[model samples]
Target: MSTQTQTETFVLHNRASPEPVVHEPAQEPEPELSPKWRYPKVLSAGMSFFVAGVNDGSLGSLIPYVIRSYGIGTDMVAVIAKRYGTTFAGWLVAALSNSTICQYLDLGPILAVGAALQILAHVLRTWMPPFGLYVVTFFLASLGQAYNDTHANTFVSSLRGAHRWLGFIHAMYMAGCLVSPFVATAVASANQDSQWALFYLFPLGLGVANLALLGVSFWDRMALAPKRRRHVAGMSGGVAAESSGKSALMEITVTLRTPGVWLLSLFFFFFLGATITAGGWMVEYLVNIRNGNVKDMGYVPAGFYGGGFLGRLILAEPTHRLGERRMIFIYAMLCVGLQLVFWLVPNIITEAVAVSLLGFFSGPFFATGISVGSKIFAPELRSSAIAFVFVLGQIGGSIFPALTGIIASRVGVQVLQPMLVGLLGAAGVSWLVLPKDAGLHRD
Candidate 1:
């Protein structure tokens, strides 16, 4: 009956029981919830495209300001420098995405990394780095855009009603382009000559919002930890890991060898060359060649982008229903005719109208090309194939504008019209040569 004896008896009783009373540990604090859009995945993806549009659209308007700030006569050389950087970064992403790296990651983290790069680019621009260093920002921004937009393109292409969605996203891009010029022009026009660099602050804010949305919308898929592979009855873990790497390489090699990929890439090589050249140089072309008022002409590029926005919105379903192939050919011809008008006309108002009409005709070309690409390649090959085409497109985007600038510095900016005309012709031809049945609805 001693206290020690009683305690010992109680312990014995507890130990002897079939199940002892159990106490749970205190629950850990839940992590803070992230901010997110209430909209679904498709809309989130569209927002990313809109961000890209804003980045791209604003450039044409900003070129005059950039030229003035840097005391450069022609901005084309700077554009080439920027594009060369972008082209290199784009190819780097294409190579890595095709390599074993993608096996361990998903699209979301890739997008986040891209967004971060863009943010850094804007931050650099906001400070107005020396001209040599300033051009480097384009490369950073282009590389980031390639990563983020390529994956977003791939994702949206797989969903139902892909053509409509493709139109929707590209339209968002044009919409961004339309809005950016007005803002950029307004800000630059208001600021002192030394303060032109401050315009980058607007995009810097947007880039931050872009990264936040990408993080939230893609949270579930964002860099999910790679699962450990269960060992086969006789296989070693090292061998399995090695085989995984090899498989990734094989997938990329197979994608590279696809004929459709090469043909599609060739088409975009010309297509994007035309698109970027027109948008990037329009303001300069108008001011210098058309006797346009510098203040008023800065808004001309918006008309081009606005036309594109309307074209994508109005023409998406028609393109799908009328047949993508036939419709594109018609669009190309119309674009050629519009360019001729823009080129031959001496009046600025006439030139502006012609440019907008050209944009309207040219707008569906990109989204439609992607739609066709989605159908031509196998699902597994789609991402790599599209990435390859996009990289080539960036090369064209860089090369032609640089070429235009170089030639313009010699013969004058008047050379842009003829160069664009030739590109449009080549693009039409490239599209005609692609395998006609690759996009068969069945498989």
Candidate 2:
């Protein structure tokens, strides 16, 4: 009953029991290490941009050829232009659908939907429907393209090294653009009436392929990139505060309030409109105003898209290194000079080279805006912020392309030369409005 007697007996009972209760060091879970190569998802999403390039660029090549088959005047052919504008505008209004649906539905599936719609659009166009039916199908197709574009851009912004991804993805778009002219032109050369349908063959194949790739790549796509915590403002002074609520509306509100956002919007507004208008109409302009043949006009648009593709590839590094703002100024200046060349030059050789250079340099401006927006906005609100900015560019793409049709209808597509000059000039001026370091955020 003594304390020593009881303690000694108890110690002996379990002293050799259970293998001496091995003293193992507690294992700490390995720190969740990010992959050495960051942002493979953003790169995966860049494929969509390649799809877009094929769509836009090929369409430009087919426009004149389609005109001959439809037996429509410049004014009537202008309906196609109008539909593109409306489609983009509709998507702009519907931009929120992406973020909303993405919260539940997988983003990869949504991209598949877009590719499917685009393929459907091409099929419908290939069938050579009556004028009315043609317009309707194109609209449906464009809606899908818009969805893919908005979602891909938003998705890329969430990844690490979003700027590089943004540039590369957009460059792929230019690459598609570069190829479209050649593809459509070649097809048109072979078959006159329904030859435009041939252009769809490539897009259809690619779309399906891309959809399959998206399925395989979804796992990697869903992984979150490293992000810093958001800083909240408080009444006590500048200090860390509790996290703020997030929503598409809140993101839009925050982005809209920033002067940089609006200014960037305006910059895109003019540049996007100008680029789409110029590239879309350039072939028709050459055919109608300059008496160039369909094949030759086809080559002309290629110049622009070719330049654009190169610009995207080459400018990515320099722009990132030299600073986006400075690079933008240089691009704008180059665009202005190129537009002048297009306007003043009498020979096709001069005009072709100039247009290509113009497209090449101006390509950077749009990609730059997306990259900057990704940096300026918080990751939580990124989808909405990018959607807001993209809508502005879509509006520009819609409006200006339509305007080119109207102007080309009456005053002449030749007038586009001067208008492009003015628009590029305006974009240049607006680029300066962005405060230096506006796009730099250490996320």
Candidate 3:
């Protein structure tokens, strides 16, 4: 054969038996950068809760001022104003957001709206509007809080070391609670003219700062349509892959139907009822029943929240190690003992100490509940489940305080002790009914 012919034949043979092309598994298109748990983002979220804590914690100390300024009684403030106006409205807005806008948007805008609402509410309070208008501020503030907190919680729950983060965020909340009383008390006390309206200035400033932090940390996710999971041709896995294609209504329905949801909600309902009742009414209870001075007893709620700060910080690891179920029951029993001491103790200082101890034991209940809920629900349904549980818990928070106020109006604030004991007992029982392994993977 000629050399040219041989070369052609060799080339053809090589061409016919082509080498295998090693396709590097098409590099997974770098995951559309989802918002992550950078320290700044975490701190901003924690600060949102801090703002909420300041609002909630100050209410107890300010209740006396509210009552006096508006010429309303405890029943009106607790039930009509706080329960319906603030707690109920706030949770309703939060529920609506979770079911609708949250499905379409990211955490940034939701938190911004929440912060704005709180600022508006505080502005109204600073003006000391008519009795009717004053109540509306509570509704706005609560709604804002619910919106900010619900999203912040869902975000934090998805991160590594979620338990510790949850505890830290809640501890920040308690820290806000601890600090708010001193400020609210001081502001309200310093104004002898009963113009405690100035106290709202403190939270107003915090609300603005909260809005600023959320804006900066979540800047990337601010746009509603862009941030949503878009299924690219190759990037199909992880959360986006598992993302439930179901409509928001369907997701909410599925979450509602879960037995674990109802059980957890029940536990939180009673738990929050006790918590809000103790914190909201303790000042009035001391002033009326124990003959505590208004100025001094105004700071009592701080003791309760202070204990909560310590408990969540100190007991988070223990609660996880010792078992959530076991630790909560023990805490309830301890709360009962402390309540008894508070009830029987005649001295104001002793009552204050007892109530503070009650707060300490009760502190871990909220963070632990969130930790457990995150573990139990399916990933897709987690947000709805948490929001449902939290809103229902807020309902309990509203109901018990309202009921206490009503009864106190008729009977006396002395009834707070018995009401707390009953609520705590109910919460413990509810916890018993939850399935041991309720998460989607377990089922």
Q: For each of the candidates, give the backbone clash count.
A: 0, 3, 2
Model 1 residue 246 CA deviation (Å) reads 2.4
Which rank order by TM-score, best down to worst?
3, 1, 2
**Which order, best to worst by lDDT?**
3, 1, 2
C-alpha displacement of 175 in model 3, angstroms?
1.0
RMSD of 1: 15.6
> Per-residue CA lDDT of candidate 1, range 35-134, in tens?
2322355676777778788888887788777777777866445354435555456556655554455555566777787789889988998877898777
Mind sharing the TM-score for model 3? Answer: 0.87
Q: State each model's C-alpha RMSD to the native.
A: 15.6, 15.6, 14.1
Candidate lDDT scores, in order, read: 0.71, 0.64, 0.75
TM-score of each: 0.85, 0.81, 0.87
Q: List pairs with backbone clashes in candidate 1.
A: none
lDDT of 3 by residue, 294-395 (tens): 999999999899999888888877776666777888888898888888888798888878888888888888887877776666655666778888887788
What's the distance in Å from true for residue 9, model 3?
A: 63
Backbone clashes (count) for model 3? 2
